[model samples]
Target: MTINKYPIIIISLILLSLNLQAAENYKKFDLPLDLINYMEISLEGKTAVMTVFAGDSSQSFRMESLEDNRSYHEISYQGSVVLNNEGFMSSGAGYPFDLIDKTDVVFDNKKTRILFYQKDPESDVKFRSRKKNNISIFNDINIAGGDFIRGSVVSFWADIVINGEVNEDVIAVYGDISVGQQAVIRGDVISIDGKVDIAKGATVYGRVQASGGKKKFQFDRWTRWHNKEKDFSTIIRFYYDRVDGATPLLGVQFTDEDSLLPNVEIYSGYAFSSEEWRYYVGLEQSFWLKHPITLGGSFYRKLATQDDWLMQRNDNTVFALLATEDYRDYYEAEGGYIFGRFTPLSYFNVEIGTLVEKYTWLDAHTDLWSMFGGSKAFGSNFGSVPAAERASGIEALDGAEMASIILKSDLDNSDREARFGQSFWMGTAELEWLPDGWNDDFDFTRYFVRAGRFQSLNEYSGFYIKAGYGGSDGLLPLHRRYFLGGLETLLGYRHKEYSGQEFWLGNVEYRLTFPKTDITGLLLYNAGQISEEAGKLGDAEVKQSIGIGVSFEESLRLDLSRRLDRSDSSFQIYVRLGINF
Candidate 1:
């Protein structure tokens, strides 16, 4: 054998190449038996090779003609037939039925091996019987039971069954996933250019993110002064509440410039109250007809409930229902406007529109028809009676008289334009009394004018001082105006605490802002008066406070104030989440 090793090696190389060429032209075969029964089979040209195996030791088969291509050999087996390192066998091309009842067998082509058995064998079963061999090379190969072309990539497309749990992330970027009914995914899922279809009983433990290249633009300049993208993005937030249960806050917007159309959005939250269940819905839309003109409108509604009515009295009285366990209430409000804007000058713009509003309230055992006085009716007195006499004089005015008074005064002049219209309708003309450069020379100046029985004056332009005489009915409460605190007036005190109907109401503020940071400082002074008549000086109330705070990214603000009126005054804290204007 040593003297002729070269001849034997040359013959083996020729036979190996012939077998590979034969496999290239192999034809597939379909047998009547179940495809899962036989261990493995493959075809090569006119020859079909198969390996049969069984789990029972009593069952066995043999390959009697198995031999190397250079030798004529025969073997008989009562248990198993073990192929030598170099062995070959050939048979007619077709499904092999002769080896179906074999006990155990293996057919290998170096790259992959098919082990036949009646039950699933462990992955390392074949290697356990062999010794000192690297098994990783065989793992790169797969056993194919059906006809598969040699040298072609094999892709498994059937449904994957994972009996246990997968503890790590699973990502699919461009493929479709059809989850089985019993499947469960316990991690986050991110899909791009693909879709995941979860069956009826499937569950996903983490969030699912799905996105596409869809263009969206939102113009929410009014609410989001600092973050322009927030107006255009869609967001969903899940939150758990104490009483009303868990809920999701959603925001969405869309816009189309070619069509000159845009849409507004809203969200759901319990920030408005902590006691009762609450919800809000809002929407707005706008469009441009011409280049210079635009039209828009919006609608919003809020609903809540509370138990007791909280009252605050100043020049007017406000009643708010506070939430309690036994009481429930709801409110709905909706309004819209159609507006047109015109820019007559480069630096100046004007906008005008008509607004319509409707509000409704519902509750258990509540007076929905109760009358509420407005700003215009707060100062109106029916006659010249002292405060004590006027309080008891309600019996003198009948229903018709009260109705006449309300219709003539309150309903007609609550709005600034309406008041001016009423004055013009009564054959009266308003005069403009602007003191030339009132604040240029002195901090204080005076201006006065008369319209019928009404007279008005201003000291230092900032302080509106008024006195009137003429009508026998005495002073109409509408003319007696004063301020407590507001955005434009007292920045130091709460707007609810300020009240007056006559005399002096003035505010002075020194404001400074740091150029390097968002901090703003303010020192303010506020004063006001209330009276039964226009000429009489009412009670004098003065309020002053100092505060400093910072605006967060120009979107939110927090301010703290110390009241100057009292020694033990608690610091008033305010949080504004959005723009004040």
Candidate 2:
């Protein structure tokens, strides 16, 4: 659905054109402040109404929150109005007003379109920053007449002024790009939310494009505030599963650019079915000596799962709600850990951590129901048990405490610029050790490695291959074992039909992307083996499947797969969100 922004834009232009008004000119409405982060005040003659938004959108704020006292204000209607950020709401025009710092807001009563202030081409901040770096954030860039920049000049939340020559693209985000007389640009000149002013004598060898206006610029500020990339932001999330039922979670994350500390995250949630609370708090600090290194620690009590390789939480929730089928088991993990990470290269990182955790087995609730399949109850949470053990009875795992040293490494070169069929590859390795001398009931060492590569045949097609291996050197805990034959791993078989202590799997796919569209087609093949023996993957009977599917923008997908190893095998239908590997 397309939203019409013309009315909002017209309202904003009028308010910005008027000069600052005196405080006594217009009548004030003493509306009570609510708990939302945004407040709006709409005026119609002598009557003024107040309302607040959940974050920055149009959603009505109904519940009280203790998240923060800061909020953005929106004021509307024609009048000489002065507002102090004392908890009043606005109705029409959306101008960004910081309630904490800005003591007064003035709006115009006349209707007129106004443009943002233009940056001076000869400013020193721009000229000095040009030679130091080609890119600036929250700061303007100026290229003097005599200066020649050999590469692209980019500014984020800032403006760009050019009187000299630029060899590549000049881009400004939420800011303007001004090409002075006699200036030359070899590449595209683009402004995302601001204007582009090119003098008659200015030479742009490439395309010139400008989109959005000043009113929308204020909207972008609200967008950035609530965006995950923001330095400080809070998020509200809802989750569902057979074990937890319905869970509502709230999270806050903060980071300072100029400070030594780089990141902090806190989350708290409640599970309605289990009637339990979950929480997490973590912090990370970065040190720059010769290379960048980070040290961090966290404490958390969470509904944990190890089958992320099979399906993500949100995708599994859909299956659980619609069909009473959950592809993953759940457990309660309460733990605290400290870790250090080092990134010697942009696409690679290695982390070493020590984890101490107490684990409790979770039971699937039979009383809770799904939208469909109301007659079927949830399966036992116990994982990978043999046939004889399942025939006797399924029992919850004994609670245990264990300590382990963890080592992990990741390498990837995926192209973030492309939506699909990018020629990239990634690999990861992890190892965990629980020594017996630590007085823990579990004594084992586990290791897993996975790697994948994608080769773009062209803009229209691609080929992908992936393989993984997992095995244990000691007595592996029930929750720490391996399983195969599922939607993502083995499409033709039942969920987790193959369970064992060791496993190896391989998958290959050929993808075709239609031109000028988001639709894509795929041909897939899968092979895997699993066994009770620690290193019997090679000797175990191999299972195989072949399938075909289509996807829309790499999101929703449907596939029909059939087993190649069995004569009586039939086609199985599967739905998925994305390619897991």
Winning model by TM-score: 2
Q: For candidate 1, which ten residues in a row score worst on lDDT?
A: 401-410
Q: Each model's TM-score?
A: 0.28, 0.61
Query: lDDT for every model?
Result: 0.30, 0.65
On the 0 to 100 scale, the lDDT of residue 87 in model 2 is 27
Candidate 1's residue-wise lDDT over 1-581, tens digit each? 01233443465456445444543543221121211343443322223334543333222223322222112222223322322112212231222222222211122332122222221222112212212111111012222223221111111111222222322222332233354444344433333234545454443433344222331122232322221122266757543212222334576665432223355555655422222333344333432211223345454433322111111111011111111111112233344445443322222233433433333332222211113312211111222234554443333221111000000010111112112111111111111111223222111111111121111111111111122212212222211123234332344555424433343344443334454554444444444443444445534444565565555544555666666777977766654443321
Candidate 2 lowest-lDDT run of ten: 110-119
Which residue segments of model 1 deviate by more than 4 Å?
Answer: 1-251, 257-259, 262-291, 303-331, 343-349, 361-495, 499-542, 546-581
lDDT per residue for candidate 2 within 1-581, as digits (tens), equals 12233543454344323211211232221111211234333322223334444343552322121112212332222331222222233454442332211111213342111111111222111121222126555668999998887657765567899999887678775588899877877656767557888776566644566655332222222222232233578968777887888889999988743224468999899998878899999998865422346679999998988888789888888888887877788778899999877655446777778898888766777556788977887776654466575433223234778788777889786644243434567889998866457734776778899998877666678878889999887756667878788676888987788877788899888989788888889899999998887866779999999999898888788888988999999999888886576
Deviation of model 1 at 215, angstroms:
30
Candidate 1: Cα lDDT at 233? 63
Cα RMSD, each candidate: 33.6, 22.7
Backbone clashes for every candidate come to 5, 7
Residue 37, candidate 2: how far off, in angstroms?
48
Instruction: Give Cα distance to truth, residue 70, candidate 2, Å.
Output: 52
